[model samples]
Target: MGLNGQIPRCEHIDRCPVVEHGPPECRACLALGQSWTWLLVCLSCGWVACSDDSRGGHAKAHYQETDHPVVAALEPSSTWRWCYVHRRNV
Candidate 1:
């Protein structure tokens, strides 16, 4: 929820094609022989990529390229979800 009484919403959540279980590392970084800070799973298409904190920022790139709206943390214990369109956690 925001400062106002409105409930938070993410329109793209329903558009997710699949929800992926992330790999041990960013496959993109590994293919490039680079390191990454963390991983994000694209909810729209189940693409796994490096987080923005990582050098590659591949997760963001996936969103930019695909116009995908949401991604979630790939960590096993995580429940965090990010909305690329809204630029906020949803």
Candidate 2:
């Protein structure tokens, strides 16, 4: 997702995560002693997970398990989100 325009909401969109900046790091990364190129945050539950680029792929797994369609990049500088169901920027 590009960093411009109004971000669309996914079915699982919850509250504005703007209050808290993206998580400092991917929890799964630390837990697995793995490095993550990108982090993904579950908007509905605030679950910190890793992107598919990482070995864990925890974020994508979380979506598959929880049906949580909404996830934003956990990088502090990233301002876009992705909808797993629609496979597009949200």
Model 2, 1-47: lDDT tens digits are: 33576555554445435434346677767977888877778886788
Task: List clash counts for every candidate, in order.
Answer: 0, 0
User: Which runs of model 1 end up more than 4 angstroms from their true locations?
Assistant: 1-7
Question: Which residue pairs show collisions in model 2?
Answer: none
Best by TM-score: 1
- Give the alpha-carbon lDDT of every model: 0.85, 0.75
All candidates: TM-score: 0.82, 0.68
For candidate 1, write residues 2-78 as lDDT tens digits. 55877667778766776555566788899999999888888877788999999999999998999988999887799
Q: Which stretches in model 2 have alpha-carbon errors above 4 Å?
A: 1-23
Rate residue 41 of model 2 by lDDT.
80
Candidate 1, poorest ten consecutive residues by summed lDDT: 15-24
